[model samples]
Every structure is written in C-alpha cells, then in structure tokens.
Target: MLIPPRVPNRREDGLLHFDLLPPLSLYVHIPWCVKKCPYCDFYSHAISSAVPEERYLTALEQDLEASLPLIKGRQVSTVFIGGGTPSLLSGDAINKLLVILRNKLLLTPDVEITLEANPGTFDDDKIKAYREAGVNRLSIGIQSFNQKHLDILGRIHDVNQAKRAVEIAMTHFDNVNLDLMYALPHQTKDDLDADLTMAISYDPAHLSLYQLTIEQNTYFAFNPPDLPDEDTVADMQDMIEMMTATAGYEHYEVSAYAKPGRACRHNINYWLFGDYLGIGSGAHSKITVDGKVIRQTRFEQPPTYMLEAGKGRAVDEEFTLSHEDLGFEFMLNALRLTKGFYPEMFEERTALPLDSIRPYLKQAEKRGLLYRDPTIIRPTEKGMLFLNDLQQIFLPDE
Candidate 1:
C-alpha cells in the first residue's frame, strides 16, 4: 500500500532520474546520553547539566520544517528516532515532537514509528507514554544481561535494570527489538548461551545481535580489552545463527534478526538503497531529487545545530553522488541482505542499469563469493561470512 512519488521523465540533462522515487524513511537523532559507553563512538555527548529539552525540541522542529520542501509530495513509510538515548526525554516531550512531525510531514497511515530506549533511563510510565505518543515500536538497548559483561562494556544499566527494561517494553509494545552484543572481552560460550536464552525467553518481535569490535577514537581502542580471538568470534556467530533459527528468528541482515513479518522496515528501506531524511545534531541523510542522489549532514554539536536550525539552514554539508558512487554505494547496502537484491531493484534504486556492475559481479563470482542468475543476485555463504571483502569488490577503483 506504499505509494511512491513519480517523476514525469526518466532522465534530465544526462543526469540520473528516477521514474519512481524509492520509499522514504525519517530519522531523528537525540544527541545526549546520561553517560557515554567506553566502546561507543556515535555522535552523542554525556549530559553534564540538565538537558535543554525545550530548546533541542524546537531546533528539531525547525530543522524538519526547513527540509520539507526537498521531500515534498513523498509519503514517508517509516520513522526511527535514534540517539544518544532518546528515552532520556520525557513522554510529553516525545508527544510534542511526534505531533510536530505529524503536522509537518506526509507520513503513511500505518507508519512504523520507533524510538530507541536505554535501560536505567526509562520506567514503565515513560515506556507507556512513548507508546501513547504514536510510537508503535520500541528498540531497547539491552546490550547484555550478564553483570560482568555489562560492567566490562561500561554500560550504564545493571543486570536487573536490563531485565526490567525489557519486561516494561514488552508490557507496552507488541513490536520490540532488543539490541545484544556477543564476543565480549573474556566472554565464554556458556556466557553467550545464557544471554541468548535470556533474550529469547521474552519472545520479543526482533533481535539485533552484534559482535563487539574496538573502533578508532573509542576508549576500548586505546586500552584494548582481552577479546576472544577471530576463530572464537566466528564460532560465536555460528552459534547465534543456530540458536536464533531454533527460536523462529530469521537472519535477515548481517546484524539483525527477526520473527516472521517483524523485520525492521525502516532499516530494510536503507538496505534497499531507499531515501531517508535524517534530522538533528550529527544526523546524516540520503535524498533522491532533481534527477540525482544527494547526501546531507547536520552540525555535530548540539549548540551549533540549534543555532544553524534557527537560521532555517541546519545542514552543514551536502554533495551529489557520482555514477561510480551510485554503483558502489548501492551494492554496499543491498548486498548486506541474505537474499540479496534483484536486478530490477538495482535499476530502480540506483537509476543505473545492471550492466554497470557486471564486471564487479563477474569478479566476485570468479572468487566464489557471489551467486547470480538472470533474475536475482545474492551473496553465497562464503560471501556473507566475508562480507567486508565482498562489498569491497564493487568499490569504484576496483
């Protein structure tokens, strides 16, 4: 029932033009967390003083209002409010924010609205308030249930707090996603098994299982923890696939799993190379318009973003994607799916013929990393295991 915006012409001035615009999603970022995790690197600042909720919300509204003209007439299919812990805001704040979005944007009747919550930051009433605010879905950041692992990861919530958060989320929302990470420092197979068992016990609609990795500029990178070796991590992944399959979860994406018909639709739009407008401090956006694909970003700092937004221009950077950029970027996202994508989808999203990636396809196939017939293109098992290498094959230089 999703209706896409249509373009009258196919091409303009030798530039790419979409006959039908890809499905669009909306992302709102809240840039404050009670405390930053040691291994985290997302654009989030720890709260030293009381959050300027009213000022920040005003900035978000202004930011969205100014960007509406670019996405005029397009129906938004999904909305995901992510963060530095968006749950830090009060339920009334969330209500006001969604009301503004609803008033300004053309959201579908059944738009899947999601807000990310962290343990220790929300109670049952807050969770209930979020649900009442038209947020139909909740994604909780319950990184681990093990006390030792939780401490090692420097998470703000304790084991009991994690369980309480999930219990509360399940009480209010039917569609919920739990974010868990495995392959932690000094974590054992039994430890992971216990965590997975605890997560499945709730029968949540979806689960996002991730392998912990130390990223540059994070505390963990400077003082690296004693993580399990590569082979052990591989075994842990295999164990996750088997366990989740037994629990009726589908391994849809590399780091995402879900029950039947419960996949994260907003994220799926991303994997399909669809367009999304991201608003807030340090948020990024991919938009298709004027016969071209453009990328945009807002200022990273909260104060700077609010000041810029008040001036009716919150975006700090913008650039159009080249043909090479299109081909590589499309595959970069599409190939993450287990079922991969169809040639028709590639053409629709990238506005480029499948012929553009023929050489890269052949190269990947030659290395036994890809599978393609006339109708579909997918990554083989080996390809999924070595996903980074497979995605790198389609790089512009390659």
Candidate 2:
C-alpha cells in the first residue's frame, strides 16, 4: 500500500525545463552495525539484539511502492544496497528482497546491483547466495589490513579477515571494490605504503581510497587523534594515484579508481547527477517530475521509518529544489568527477541552462580554480586539488 507523493504548490516557472529524462537507479540503505565505528558519520545504529530483517524488508517494499509514482516510465539500471552493513542480513533475505524489487520495478536485464559487505559479517555460503540473488558487484569495507590500524579505527576485522573476505567476494563476483582509507593517527609513510601494496596485490576491479577526515559528532571528533599532517596526506594521495595507475587502474572520481569499463554505474549516475530512488531508513532520493527536480528523505530512525511506511507515506521531509539551489547541488555532485561533466548535462539534469551559473563559472576559471572549454567542461588539475573552492563558486550568495 502506498500513497501519491505530496508536490508543492510551486510551479516550474523561473526554472529550466527538460525535453529528455536522465538515467535512473535505486539505492537501499540498511542501517544497523555490529558496533559503531568512531570515524563513521553515516546513520548506523549499533545493535544489542538481532536485526529485524524480515520486518525491515517488508517496510522497504512498502517504501519503494510509495515511490513508484516518481519513476513510472523509467527503467532502473543499477541498484546499490549500502549501509551500516548490508552483508549482515542473511543471504535468503537478500534473495527475497531482490525478488520483491524485480516484481515491483522495471529493472534492466543487465542491471548492475552492488552490495556493501563488512569483512567479518559474511561467509562463503552467504556471499555465493548473494551472487545467486543478482548481486553482480561487492564492495568490501577493508579500511586497512594492519591489526593495529584496524584497532585504531575501531574496525572489528583483522588483516586475515580482510584478505579472506576479498578472496571470497572475488571468487563469486567479477566486479569487486575494496574500500580502503589512509591518513591514520601516528600513520607513517611506511604504514601507508604497506597498506597500498597489500590492496594492489588483491587486484580488485575497483578501489575507493579515501583520507581519514574527523567529522563533527563522531568519537574521533570529540577526542581527535594525531592524524598525518596536510603535506603527508597529500603525498599519500599522490602516491596512491600513481601506484594505482601503474597497476592498470584508472583514477576516475576523486576517491574512486577502476579497471577498464569497470567503474561503479550507480555512483557514476550520481556523479553525473542522474535520478535515483532511495528506500529504507534515512535513505535520500532525488527525482525529476514534469521538469521540476524534487528531493525527499524517509525518517532517519528505523522505527519511525517502519511506522511511516506502513501508513503508505514514509517521507519525513520533501522539497522541490529551487533553480538557484539546483545549480549548486548539481555542481557539488558533478565536480567530484576527475573529468568535468559535459555542458549538456547541466541543462539535462538540472533542467537549468548553463548560462544560469556562468558568472560563477567565470570567477572559478579566472581564479585558476577550473579550466573552461567551449566544447567540454571539466576541472583543471589545480581545481581537483582545491575542489571545495571551485564548487563554492556555484553556491548562491545569500
């Protein structure tokens, strides 16, 4: 059971309109973890008892059913099951979820479905069942293999578990991504070197390497650790990029690398500002309807989400993005690509003309924050290093 979405009284006037629609995707969030990681800012609750998997799955079905009106004629090309630990669910549950999705949505035959699995949360049997359940990609969170570093990061798995998890995932799936982080407290050049070397050795199809940033409200934020200095972190990033390239990986997005034609389709859609329907607790969604761009989010708390979905309306907040705000939000996502997006994308995705933000774009190019081209739009290498300033240009002055 689902209800129609609540659209605002505002019209698409004073905003750009689109004649064509962009690609569509789906994102599923599972918000429970064995323990809360100190550095994670994602909405994940640490569990003391067993996860309510069956009930959660039922709620997701209703949530998705409610979103059907937003994506009526489009075909879903990718589905990403990401969260606290999607792998924590039993394989049978994953199978049922996929079956439920297929029955409700028009998914492409070669749809790329990805699952985020923790090293200690899954086994060989569970993973193989996931493959059987239509998961073609597996993103294993192997932040670091060093036991001491793992402890510092509050990760439960050790080097052995990380290696074994990758091995199991690779055995069943062709598209495997290893999520690794660098710049730890007391981390040395040698420490990072060892981690990179180990990661490259695994030969994953994709790698998401990120720096350790202490965010607000996390444990690390309260009791900050001595992370690598700015220069060291930059050097580490440079080194990883060079090494991954040498190992035959393409540095596509800021923190993502992939083999030939192996980039994550779901993420690429997001970076390209493609539309997606996100279901489950705390999941966020952006969709286009009648040339207007609208965004919505379900209740952040799992209990609240379940209750709301049962009533056929799960959205806690919904708003139509203003023309001024759409330009800034689109830039935030598109600028993350190593190669800048095409000019056509601005109009097609945001339904706004490129000239709407031209003044800010000129400012960025004048400040040497971006390289402007008549045929293509992308950031200069300098812009890549200072992305925040480049994207800030598109932000409206309030």
Candidate 3:
C-alpha cells in the first residue's frame, strides 16, 4: 500500500472554532462510459477501448492529497462512486482505490460506500469483489424494463439484462438501489406503472425515480422526442408516490423512495446541505473550513484532469461562497426533502441566520407552498408540485 499524504493543519486555535460542522461525504466521479445517453447532461465521455485504470487511480489519490488540508479534522460519513459507469473499472481497481481512501480519510466503521453501475455491466464475481472492497451498496441503472422504452432511452442493455443484473446483485449484496426514470418520451401511465411494478417486485432497498427531461446541448434537446403531455406526466408522478408508499417505501426526497433504514445516506447528505469532497474529472467539492465554505472543481476533461492531478493541482476553479450564495444553496438542497428540514439547521450548515430567508418563507407559506411548525419547516403537497416556484424565493437578493 502507498503511504498517504500529510494533511496540513492551517487553522489557528481561535479561528478554527465552528458551532457545528455538517457531516462530510466523499463523491468520486468516473467520467468514462461505454456510451453517453442523449438526455444526460452530466460530464461524461464515450469510450470504446481500454480504460486507463492505473493512471486514473493514481490521479484520484493525488487529487485527495491536494484536498487533505481543506478538510483536516472532519471524518467522511459516506462515499459514493458515481459516473459514466463506475462498473467499467475492474474489481481489483476498486479494491485498490478503496484501500487508498481508507488509508487517507477518517471513514467510520460500517461506512456506507456505494457505486453506480449500469445494467449488463457486472456479474456474480464482480459484485462479490465489490462487497469485499468495502462497497456496501449498489445502485443499478435500470431506466425501464420495457424493451421499447429501454431502446428509446438509448440504454445498451435489454430488459432481461436489467433483470439479471438485479438478481445477481441481490445474491451478493443486501443494500441495493434501482434507478428508474418515468414520463419517458411517448410513455403512458400503464407503461410507467409497469416499470414501477417490475422495480418493486425486485424489492430493491431504494429507488430513485426521476422524470426524463431534455437537457441543453444533448441530442434530445435539438431533436426533441414526442413525450407524454403535462397532464399525463403529472398523473405518472402521482401514481409513483402512491404505489411506492403502498409497498411500504417512504417517499423521502422529491424523487427518492426507500424501505425502512435503507435510504441512500450519501444522497441524503446532499439533500441536507451537508459537506462533501468531490474528486475526478468535473467532480465538484463543497467543504467548510474554519466556518467559511469554499467550492472547488476539478478539470472538466478526463485527460486534462489526469495530467493536472500529477502536479497536485487537479482543481481548475475554486471560490468561497458569499453569504447570499450560502443562504440560497442551503435552501436549494434542504427544500428537496419531502419531510423538509429543521429551522436551526440553516445556521449550522451555512453559518447564515434563518432570517435571511424569513421573508421568502413567509411568502411561500402564505401562498400554501410550505408548512412551518415551531421546529420543523416542510413543503406542502402544492410546494412539492411547484417546487421550482418555492425554491426561487430563496435566491440571493440582487
């Protein structure tokens, strides 16, 4: 094993104090995939040949080394390896990367490590090795089991492949999440219901149900597909919530459903406005040091990031969040939760007083978009439906 880099303690005793520091999570992005999906806008590149495994691993380590000083004392509560297709990396590579991360970061025992995999990617041995590599969760991307829908979505795997992936995952791991998209182009209510039924049949621990939307610069944006009308899409969302709840899964986040004690901790952290260190190409990090939050972004291109990592300067852009920026950011994340957030959490996470958004909160409540008690503040059913309008109230004042 390689020796980890030393973390510098740059804080003075008086300046280092924080009333409360939010939980830290690590997000490692894998930018390469067999092919890029059209509706997807996240930074991803298509690759057909061999993956540069060793080089990327080394770069990731150096990326962390450069980050150590910023997050000196906090412990990482969870890790999520997301991407173009993290499963594309070999099992041995995953083991090696986890080993190095464990050596460097103060990860808790029983830490939740998750990896995102596409259908048709892994088999029995690979899943087993991932479990051994300290990855406790697997999120299988099964957009839809309907063959026509799958092909329309440009998924490489067939319906059988998606089913087989889940079956193999169940045998090796207990915690699994299925990523399913609804309101796909030309999809009907029955089409969506069937997809949800198939997902529920597997009894995955968690499900991320998102509506497919055309993103700017993607193929779908230019050549928009004929999609379900607004009314039909709304019906689909309603059906999803009722069905998942009936099956005993909690509709936690706006688009997340999970069984008891099976919610995705990493994503929950994000929704709670918690801190995280992001690594790899186009990975973004939000860390609070000495009560001031700073953001950093690695080089956007894979080749550029790899080269920059060698010099311990993978971060191409970095900035401290303004007070107004912090307030808006906190609301942006916290309002995503169905159950909402505690009133005082705003201060703890963003170091901004709750009064910053008090006017907006009042206005939203008056409009029936939110419900506030003495302690907790949550979105109303209307707020969940018109989430964009509710969140817009919290934007930084001009």
Candidate with top lDDT is 1
lDDT of each: 0.92, 0.89, 0.88
C-alpha lDDT (0 to 100) for residue 235 of candidate 3:
93
Candidate 2 local distance difference test against the native: 0.89
Candidate 2 residues lying further than 4 Å off, grouped into runs, are: 1-16
Q: Model 1, range 15-37, lDDT digits (tens) per residue?
A: 77677899999999999998889
**Residue pairs with clashing backbones, model 1:** none
Ranking by TM-score: 1, 2, 3
Candidate 3 Cα lDDT to native: 0.88
Which residue runs does candidate 3 get wrong by more than 4 Å?
1-17
Q: List clash counts for every candidate, in order.
A: 0, 1, 0
Badly placed stretches (over 4 Å) of model 1 are 1-12
2 or 3, which is superior by lDDT? Answer: 2
What clash pairs does model 3 have? none
TM agreement with the true structure for every prediction: 0.96, 0.96, 0.95
Model 1 worst lDDT run, 10 consecutive residues? 1-10
**TM-score (C-alpha, index-matched) for candidate 3:** 0.95
Report the C-alpha lDDT of model 2 over 189-250, residue by residue, as the tens digit.
Answer: 78888988998898899999988999999999999999989999888988998899999999
